[model samples]
Target: MTITFVHLESVHHKLSKASHKADPFSDARESGLDIRYATISDAFPLDHDRDLHREKYWTTLLQIFPSYVDEFVRKLIRSDPQSLHFLVADTVYVWPTAIARKYNLINVSFFTSPAHVFSLLYHLDLLKERGHFLRKDDAVDIDYVPGVGSMRIRDLMASLSKRSDITGNTLFKAFEEVKKADFILHNTVEELESDTLSALNKYQPNYAVGPINLSEASSVAVSRSLHAEVDITKWLGSKPAGSVLYVSFGSVVQTSKEVIGEIAHGLRLSEVNFIWVARAHLTSSGDSNVLPDGFVEEVGDRGLIVPWCDQISVLSNPAVGVFFDALWVEFGGREHVVRRSDDLFPSDLRSADGQEVGGW
Candidate 1:
């Protein structure tokens, strides 16, 4: 089967393509597969920066996304009426199922996040009916969500746990439509999330074939980073094995200045050799320096902070030890120390919900 990776073109990806920096699709070309590629306009101007005006950007995109998908699919079918087509989409988009049905294509909903998160989103109505949606009490246990077993309400992604905004509402709507998908694909491990996947499968044809980001070219390092990456090889290599802590909340996940300050203070107080991906758009307030005052001075040579780096390379590094998506909230300041890297896997590597997060 021919698989064409269709990218909803973004300004950052456009820049990356022009410069030939961090080609996310290079490995695909090198794989010698029947795979093809295409880019559809996200209906945003070339100069538009989504990070600068995130709310407006997403709100506008969500409003017009269905129309864009409809146009793209319509054109795709017109281009090749003879060839059979299967439409696979990220679960975040609301129009995939309808678009697929319109074009007589098999629709597949792919959930890239953890299956546990998917379970919560899939059962949004259950959460609402049970007074769990936007509940004030974070301490309440949420065991009723199918396959999720027992997890606290607060453990959910802030978007799921907290009050709903336009973006959140749109995301919830997308998940609601995902139920109509012909098939559901999760980028997760079946062994790890077997229960969750099994529960989801009862509703639809669900499959757990993942760590998909790794691709067939596992040895070849590739990054789809929109930001310029800092080469931390020399600095990271200097650190002893299992001594450095790697901290990043990912490209799009934003936190407040207060959370940033707390994490910074905790890092400084911990004094562990570390590399922190302090992306330029890490905060919504647009504060360039999210680090606390004297944070750099206090940490000095012990910490190497960067805008971004090739995450796969960093994780593969033997010198690197702990990886923290969340901050030092789990590990108290100065008191708790990460001694052995082995001690941090499977057990310590848990979501806020206390579920063991499977790694790539």
Candidate 2:
């Protein structure tokens, strides 16, 4: 199969290419797939004059996407690669799927999250029709997502749970596009999301392609340094095997200084050894000041804070006991205690109606 990827030639796209430097496509050409890149200069250009509004940005992208993908595919076919056996793209850009249909090619749309999240997004329009999209003050905050378990309003994608017009509108656009794709690629594995995957109907055949656990040296696992103050490798090595807790909240989630302080206080109170990968952009002051006052003194060599480091390498270190994508929700003015997955989801949802939501 010749797998062609049609994408924008943007800086972020270049970075993603760098991340996938070890292209299985190039290597696996003899194995099965003959890969091709059909890229254009910044297909969805952003505004330089002002900050881009999310809703306007996505709407504009969608408006322009069909024509762009149509041209890209037609040109590729004219060049004669025997027609694209498979065309893949981010689910957010559904134009490729439409192009695939025109050219009689298989379209695989990628979702870079879990099957449960994908399921929620897939049924978002239906939820809206059923009047279940958002909570009314008169109504309860709890609702059952089709494939996923009982979802608390606080637990919904921060966008849908809140009254964010931009995110909700853009999200609706993205998922609506997803439904038209012939195939969906989820970033989670089958066992972890077996029930949710099963719930995907015949309309769109889905695959559990990842939860892509790559090694530090894996071609796809490239790292760029942000904070170089402390040596994370040396720090993790100093601790005992499986003794240190690793805390990081990923890139998108903006965490407050007060919450980080609370985490520091909790770590101090627990008196545990831990490595905290604190990204500067996530903090209020964009510095280690996010740590609570007297935190460094109190923890006293038990904690190591860095702006950024190779998370994969840190997790691979024998000293890492647990790696948590920590989340802290604010409610009732004060910050509610941060909960790990193990704390919140102790059991799976009932599998009735083929709806398997573990921890539902």
Candidate 3:
């Protein structure tokens, strides 16, 4: 079967001219996989700083993205109508179901997060019925969501805990569209989230087959990273086991200067040797002054702060103490939570083979 990976390039994945010139699927070609790759324009300039104007950026995207999807689908089907059988897309897009219907394609929605999170968003009506949608009371218990245990609304995802913001509303609407999808695929492990996945399958065909990033590619290396990656393997090898902390807020989520300062200060106080991926555009202001004043000099050689690094490589290193990013599950580590800072190191961490490691 031929698989075409159509990447919709947005601010999160603004392509550099060099990257645009490079063949992104050379590995797939070398591996003899019948895969095709294409990059679709998100109608934003390559140099546009979306973070500097986030609200306007997202609002405009919502207005224009659907038309682009429609045109793309129309042209592709006209080119070879019978060749296309399935429309697989990220669940965040609000137009997949409609476009699939227009083309008579079987729509499959892919939710990158765990099934538990997907279940919460999929049951948006249930939240509204239980007074949890747009809920401001963070302390209230959210016990009614199917397959999810009782947790405070405070523990709920920020998108649901806070008042419906532009992005939150987009996600809510996207999930609503996702319900109409012919199939739902989750990036979660069934063994780990059996109950949650089982619950979701009752409404639609839900499949658990992810944390796919950890999977080894067949025969060739194909990199899809949007940022330049620095190698920290040598530096990490020098640190003692269970002595370093891996700090990152992920690629797209931007925080305020205040939050960056707080984390920086906490790292200094804790005296934990660390590697922090302070990616470009990490702050809403898009300024380079993300770390606190004199932070580098104060921490000196104890910390390695770079614009980006190979995260899975860093996490796999034996010297790293704990994984602090809430975005990805811990692969190896004794769980440790710093309650004062409300940081959690996930417990019962396992490697790809399901073997437990002593530390991250």
Candidate 4:
């Protein structure tokens, strides 16, 4: 059966470029799955200033795009009643399952964040009831989480507040929708989060079919093509194992000059070889030169700071010992949380039979 993947145009543009370079559809085609991308931009003009317009433009976009989404669904339903629809992630799949149910579309939801993070958000009401809503300091110890070690309240708080701001008060709506999906796919590995995955399996059919990072398997040609001028993978190949610290905070998160300076200081204190991708205009303050004076000279050849670089290529490199970024606490909190190598690749890397394997 064919599958139609519907996503926001802004996201699709990036993914289509990546997918074309990666040729992900070729694998699907080889497996007899006809895949196509349907984007909102195909149906309506996008407001580049959607955030500025706020609810007015948001409602306008929804009204305009639902028909486009519905039409795509209708075409898929007509082409093959059994055609499946995959939504990339919670943020992109803003429509209701009722719409899919009306069209008889087999809707599956994908979550790019860790499952434990979702579970925490799913129980946000409970956390709030227990006096965990907003805090002045950005850090707090989060206990009672399933499958994984404790998370700082600051990290949890940031996610919760940010979700509320972006999606309004219904924080659990996405997780609730995910549970009702035909199936759920997580961009994580079972071994990396076996405990959390086990807990999630009790509620729904969930698959931890990731690190979902294609960069690890990407060819040098694809990497160079995607990144344009900078060939990070080739440069990383020359570095020693566990020498470089890869730094990135996805595409959306922003950091201030003070926080950026702190991070630079922290990295210098850590004394690790690093590649820092400092995107321009990260803050309106325009104090992008947040690094400590003589910091680069101190590290010498041990550090490289570029304005932008391909993240996946950097993360997969053997030289990358840690991935560091400043954590923002939107609500209130003083403590910052960092994800260590162990967190990404959990310690219990062996299977039940004691065979050496890679994963959770």
Candidate 5:
């Protein structure tokens, strides 16, 4: 069957470049799958400009991308009518499954983060009961997560508040949407997060088809011509194993000045080689001057602070030992919980072709 990959406009640009680089045209064409990219064209206003907090951002996104949403529905109807549509976007925003059953298209929502993170987000109510969620400047220990041992409240992202505020309520709503998905696709391998994967399977069909390092195996000849600027693979090839800490907060998370300093200190104290992608501009309500004075200079050759970098290539490298980033409540926590590959494919589940039989 044909699969049309739908993503938000911004994500579409990035994923398209990555996909083309990963296979050129021959790979996608040979799979008997026609890969088509489409995006809803709308930009939600900044959170601060709208006077909305973190939670309300979701509601604002729904409003800003109404046309994109309508286009999604129309595209499915026009495409194959019976073909499955694979949607890979920030599930917090582009949840097409709400309308999937109505259109007879199977909606597969891909979570680039860990399943445990989504699990915690899904059980926001339970977290609230155990006092796991905390308000601004409030501290609490996160000891209830399925696989993660324990994390301090301050160590958690500020967005994990249990209060009945706009952000909290909106997040809870998003979890409801997650529950209705046809299947959940996580960008983490089974080797890293088994317990969380098992917990997720009890609720919905799940797949751990990642590290999602398709870009790592792409031909350099095709990639060089496809995109301009830096070669992240070259940089990663130079680092030592388990020495460099890969730091990024995806595309949406914004870190505050205080938290940034704290992170720099944590990295320094940890005494690990690091690569930090720190955005100068603030997309959300937070200060960007969080890095300590002379932080970059102090770290010098040991640390590289760039505005943006290729995450897939960097993460796939053997030199990079640990991945570090601020744990936004939206991102679950700092723990890197993932499932092992062997755990994902049980003997009974394998087809004659040796592929997993059940769809996820």
Candidate 6:
């Protein structure tokens, strides 16, 4: 089937440019989709020194999204539109999906997080109704989440659970919106999340066409929002091949100073060669001091910390053998966080084929 892919850049000027540069749609043109990019004119302009004050962030999203959806629908209407089979959109914004509904087109909810997380989020309201969510106090004794297994209440994704006045209301509205769609789309594969996917299918028709990393990156001229001085390639080359731990947590989640200090300290103690992507701006917010005193001095040349670098290129290098999410580093204090193969691989980790290495 022929598909036309359209991207709406709704962030402020800086972020939009970065996203367009790192867009993973250039390969679609070869596959036969008429790809398009639409920049939201009044989007919040994000910069190094600027703060997307929570209020302004949501306001801009509500503002520019309607215009973006309208423009996209206009293009669709002018083209072989009715021939279009489905309207798949991110779970956040509902305007485009609403437009699809008005046009009588099939609408599917596209969730970009792990399928288990998606399932937990989709059923969040049910949890609240059943009293599994304790709203009186943020601390509640919850044993498990719907599709996702035992996780601490604090780890419960903020988007699905209780949020502030504006954010909470917005998330619920979006959650309710997804239920109206024909089905939910996840950027995950059945092999990786078979049980979760099976459980989720009871709600809607689920199609898993992902590792989603398999998609080629955008060919459009792009830029990065992070600093440019770090030479990540050369540094990676200095490390023994496949000996570097690549640490990063995309743009959305920010680590606290305490967590950052703990991680830096642990890496030093662990004596593992690592490349860490630390967004300087995240540290700059609210606190003048973000890292532990003597963090750089303690670790010395063993760790390479940078504001940001081309992640795709860094991962592609043979020097990077293991992937470590900075969020996961919180679990580093535990005994079974990571082990080595033959002894270097994480001992408690199971092999992809299901062979037991170590049980957590």
Taking all chains together, each candidate's TM-score versus the true structure is 0.86, 0.70, 0.88, 0.71, 0.67, 0.74
Score candidate 4 by lDDT. Answer: 0.57
* Candidate 6 residue spans exceeding 4 A from truth: 1-5, 8-33, 45-51, 79-82, 134-146, 152-154, 158-162, 165-169, 215-231, 283-289, 312-322, 326-360
Candidate ranking under TM-score, highest first, comes to 3, 1, 6, 4, 2, 5
Query: All candidates' lDDT scores?
Result: 0.74, 0.61, 0.74, 0.57, 0.58, 0.62
Model 5 lDDT, full chain set = 0.58
Q: How displaced is residue 206 in candidate 1, in Å?
A: 0.8
Model 1 ranges off by over 4 Å: 11-27, 218-223, 326-360
- Give the Cα-based TM-score of candidate 2 against the true structure: 0.70
Q: Write the per-residue lDDT of candidate 1 for residues 78-157, one digit (tens) a residue.
A: 98899989998989888888889889999999998889878888999998999888764647987888898886665555
Error of 2 at 225 (Å): 8.9
Q: Cα deviation of 44 in candidate 1 (Å)?
A: 1.8
Residue by residue across 178-277, what tens digits does model 2's lDDT show? Answer: 7877788888888989888888855579899886655333333222332343457877778877677778876545556666666666676656687777
Q: How well does model 6 score by local distance difference test?
A: 0.62
Candidate 4 clash pair list? 135-332, 136-333, 137-333, 137-334, 138-333, 138-334, 139-335, 140-153, 191-360, 192-360
How big is the positional error of residue 7 in model 2, measured in Å on the Cα after superposition?
6.1
RMSD of each: 5.6, 7.0, 4.8, 6.9, 10.6, 6.0
Q: Report the C-alpha displacement of residue 140, candidate 3, in angstroms.
A: 2.0
Give lDDT tens digits, candidate 6, residues 1-360. Answer: 655555434343444454544444445555556665444444544342333365556665666657766766766677775576678788877565677767777888888877876776678766777666533333554545555676555455543344554565666678778878888778898888988888877878877777665545564323444344356888887877667777776665554565566556556655667788776445425464566788777777768877677777887888776666734532222222332112323434344577642231
- TM-score of model 6 (CA atoms): 0.74
Which numbered prediction scores highest in TM-score against the true structure?
3
Better of 3 and 5 by lDDT: 3
